[model samples]
Target: MIEESEKGWLLDNGLVAYALRVGEDGVLEHLHFGGSLGSLAGFSAWPRQAYRSLQIDDRGKPFRHLGTLAQELPFFGRGDFRSPAIAAPGLDELVFESARKIEGGLDLGDLPSARFEGAETLQIRTVSRHMGLEVVLSLTLWPGHPVLARTVTVRNISDRPHLLDRASSLSIDLPQADRHIVHLTGSWAREMHLQRHRIETGRFSFGSCRGTSSAQHPPFIALTDTDTTELHGEVLGGALVYSGNHETVVEKDEFGAVRLQMGLPGGMRWPLAPGEAFIAPQALLLHTDRGLGGMSHGWHDFVRERLLPERREPYRPVYLNTWESAYFEVDEDKVEKLARAAKKLGCEMLVLDDGWFKGRRDDHTSLGDWQADPKRFSRGMGELARRVTAEGLKFGLWFEPEMVSRESDLYREHPDWIIGADRDRPGEGRNQLTLDLSRPEVEAHIESVVASMLREADISYVKWDMNRFVSDLDDAKRAHLYMLALYRIVRKLRKAFPGVVFENCASGGNRFDFGMLCLFDQTWTSDLCDPEGRLDIQSGASHFFPLSALASYIGPSPNHQNGRISSFEARRDVAFFCGSRGFSLSAEELEAHASSVKETAGLYTSTQSLVTKGRFDRLRTGAEIIWQLTSPSGDEVVILYARKRSEPNPPFASVRLRNLEKGSAYRMEGSGELWRAESLMVAGLPMPHTDHRANPPLMKALPTGDMATALLRLRRV
Candidate 1:
């Protein structure tokens, strides 16, 4: 570790900077910076690998391709700037230069380095000084692990009081190329673009969506389905530019590095007064591999691995979801219809969704009443469970157990059961209040619901939905406590229903982070199910999650969230990325596309062991196309590829089966007959590239199209 002087001369670029001692192990472990007083570069040492250059300004223009890079930079601070060329000291120096004086003042005098009692934190400090604000970037490594994290703390230490922006900037890499930036915030991004390496930059446009925070706060950007390669190593730097008013651009470096840039309100615009500081909570993890492969391996080995990872056992079977059909209103008949459809389609379980309780309709009311809705099912809820069992399908039920509807019996009796400031003023969202699971009574209520459903209905699956975010930030206790409550609930539920599967949903994908994967068997990837959208959705989700515990449930085309239609085969191909699969479409709608849907379903089911249980090898996704290959039994292999746009000549994607014993005989169904490993061992096997435009061809015998029922039978030597 090294420390440097606070006072320093400005470089030619109008940036005052200092160097830190670089690590030899390839992990950039520590950083030492100063504001010209003295050399603080020796404060500490850091892993070189921990930091990367996030150059957001591809063309050095003030606003071109701004939002695309904004999504990557995590923490950004706002301060006064009149043609200010303020430079951040991360990612090879991604600078927010030449910006008009925004409306905030910053001070760095009282800024100090933070240290934890334990060395396990791998904590290091990053200091950046501008005219009015001093920004400190601290990274805490996960004890002894290679993964480093980012935490930004800004203080108002200036004598004259000034305001600051709420958001901070973070820069990482994006390996995917040529994908649209879909900002989750409500405010539209002005200009966005992508510039790869020394290559020229292109104009970038963002998808429309609402911001996750108030206008003054930095909005969260959700960049859905993007190829991993483009956002990988080289794409690791960018900036967050903001006006005190609207618009935030996550400018990326010219070299395609990942970065995040956000706007902050003036000090008066904040919820706090001057002299007080604000901190942005964010993190980053760098695994050896990229996308799903990297995430799956990293998560399993480092974090929790038992959350329904890929299993070859028959216990891991195809399932069906009843949510898309019933929504909130469900009963015996609706449940039965879904169960029968699932059974007919070789599904092992049927998950009954919301509105199965009394006084529940749409998303407005009812959740505490775990009891079945007698009105919807004349024969009663028990009868529905029995009917599902009789139809040879295990039964499951949906519950937003962590929430209470405003009109429900739970909230009606104990108004304090929800998280809020006052019983008179309940924090309402989605017409509901987030359950104060911290309360013993609330925990018991959830436990009883799970127990009763299992005992009464013989249910074997549960799809838990936390549709809304936790509001009433005034009660700061819930941030940490709420998460603990979630963990406890999942722990208890797993203990009681040992064999039951729980699918995690945070209004679909918001909660899809490392913390929750420890509990749920699978996570709903996204609310958008359009096949095209899902391609990037899956890719983005896999950026930090395992493909095994990920669910790619095929929601109907012209999806409920996004009204877009995709072919059944395209949907199937998208779903195959991870193992656990199901359908979220109506039986009626599925019936309309019956033949193609059935064919796609059969293709997934037949080769599922290979798809789910196999070792994954990502083939391509670095350019205009994406593809991956997996081997189930270690003998047989399957490859799937999709081209974003039609190419002059569709290139043949090659695959190498892992863990295959030499001298084994493998059979390619479409290729006919069988071939020995010795033959391919000497000369590698070539995978065919066939047009799967119509329906997938069923290659039963061999030597033709890989087909719908494409079987690649193999035998050990």
Candidate 2:
């Protein structure tokens, strides 16, 4: 709810509060953004003192107003040394011209953004008449969520056109400084590694210029105090709902105040014609005084409830993917054998990874051709799909719809469909080029090809893959337009194939963002499936995304990627916490571990409710990691994993569980031991001293080895 007062505007969403006011010179000033503020009565009295201390000099002379003022929508050329949220060539300066409240949330044409349902919105319009541009800032607050969604729209109001250099979806000023900045950064095989640093006096930022949301930096940023931890201190987090080139900036001014800005990266100048408008990406802001974990829970709930598609609560299927199992050697007979083995081990689906298309023997060719290869499958794709389904398993296919191999027939026929400069040939990655989805003809061709495949076969799932990054686009706007067109295609495909589940992958988690998450059921966490590396990868991803949106599968023991041999128990334990569980092993390979595979499948079936729908908590100290999932009604389960061997005289450490009802007695699933939640939380459960002998039993003590993992289940009594 938004309430107006003599001081400024106060927006509340039951869990968090946002307040701002107009300064004497008509500038929209930021006041407070954090925990809930009960009433607006004392809010007005605090801004004056806060601004004065942050601005005034010791000699009683006031510094430049632009440098001191914490404007909500700051512009360039206004003496403000900080980065401008919106910048244009001629009209780099802007002032607050008008402000008012609005009814529905703003729209971004065909782009995917967070929808505000039954929420209050405030629209503040600022104009630079000399430059003939008008900027509209909309801030929306939902009823029960602590998140605020912000978007900016720029209109060329004058008779001439305007070139937009930079425009951000959201920007805010924090009154204090010396806060810690936390973000995710990594590369292809290893993605989303959490890194924290102290906010210094200069600018610190990270972004993607590779066209796709590159793994170099994810679209997430957070600020917290030095004392912040998983369960304590205040944290403010923001993420963009964009999968294209984006930037997040943190600037600390001379006065020790900090400004956080997130928007489209510079260098792409969008030409806005007279009366036409350009809408920036949406930025979702979350605030929590209960620390990083609280912020994570809020983001998880927001994504699952608001960002994902409708009816997203259904159980995610456990399947077997043929990527690592078969790779480019997959054929009708091989897939049939894998499907039968998958069914024997309780897999509900079988996904033919790649090399199923015509003339496709390797990744170097046959990406655009969506038909089954007659040489490999003489019986036809429809027959193979039916045979797989007859074995009581759903059939899925892999497609790199956005890419085409130069060796493929489609690329030879339609070379104009690729995004490239007229003068220069585009550089190739993975022996492929990107299809220009921004073009209507290209989009239509992809839609028809994919639609025909789904129609020809009884396919129930698709592993959508984009193997290479986009490059050599002549137009600067092509990157943004590409993302817009991709969203449109995915939206139409979902409508056409409502029953088919889509898993988004870009050589593993490169395109991981809220925008794609809204269109697909889950994402491939990473291409590197070594159980050891995945522990960190999944942990960093879970900070912003829910476990249900992450896909974890047990791959070969001597992992195909890194050749790191891991125990089946370690791999299965880690995969169980992921939302969509699967295996990447062949039928012949599965026989050696058939009993273990069956036991793990049974465990996944029994714990599906807890892992998918329950709240998740993490407890980590050094090489030991513990993840807990608790239902809303208090049933809980925990997974403990130790990466390294213990010391010669290891200290006895207890693992404490979180999110349990205190004073309530809970029964352990295997041992039938009853313990009060209060005692369990306070004293923690002791690590077992010896290995257990049961088939699927909990560990008696912390296992010591290169790879070790244990599972514990509990129910309130």
TM-score of each: 0.59, 0.95
Output the worst ten-in-a-row residue range by lDDT, candidate 1. 185-194
Off by over 4 Å in 1: 1-297, 300-315, 421-427, 590-602, 622-624, 645-667, 673-717
Candidate maximizing lDDT: 2
Per residue, candidate 1 scores C-alpha lDDT tens digits across 1-717 of 112234211111111122323222111211322122134434332221222234243245433223232222232322111111123222122222111111112221221111222212212223232333444444333333323334455545444444443434233334324433433221111111122222224323221111112211222333323444522321121112111122234333444533333332212133224466555433333333233344334433333222232223523356777777667756666677777777776677777777778878877777676666668876766788888889997877778887788777877888777777365575567787787766777777887877777777777777787766666643333343444555677767777777777777656664554335545667666666666666656654443344665676777766676676555666676776765777777879767866766666676677665654555444445332244444644556555555444344456544444435566777765535566766644554444344445223433211222112122345443
* Tens digits of lDDT, candidate 2, 1-717: 888887778888679988887776666788888888877886543544334445433224355356666778787675565788888888655657777776758767887877667878988888887888899888899887889988999999999988998888879988865699999999888998999989988899898878878788989988999899999999999999989888999998776889999989975689999999999988989999888898889999988888877764557777888988888998877888898899989888888988888999887898888889999998888999999999998888889999999898998898888878354778999999999888988888888889898999999988899988888874668888888888988889999999998889999989899888888888988998887888888888989999878888899979888889888888887888788888888777788889988888877777777776789887774577777778867866564545554455555556777877877988887788888998888888655542343223443554656767677677888
Scored by TM-score, the top model is 2
| TM-score computed on alpha carbons, candidate 2 | 0.95
Q: What is the clash count of model 1?
A: 115
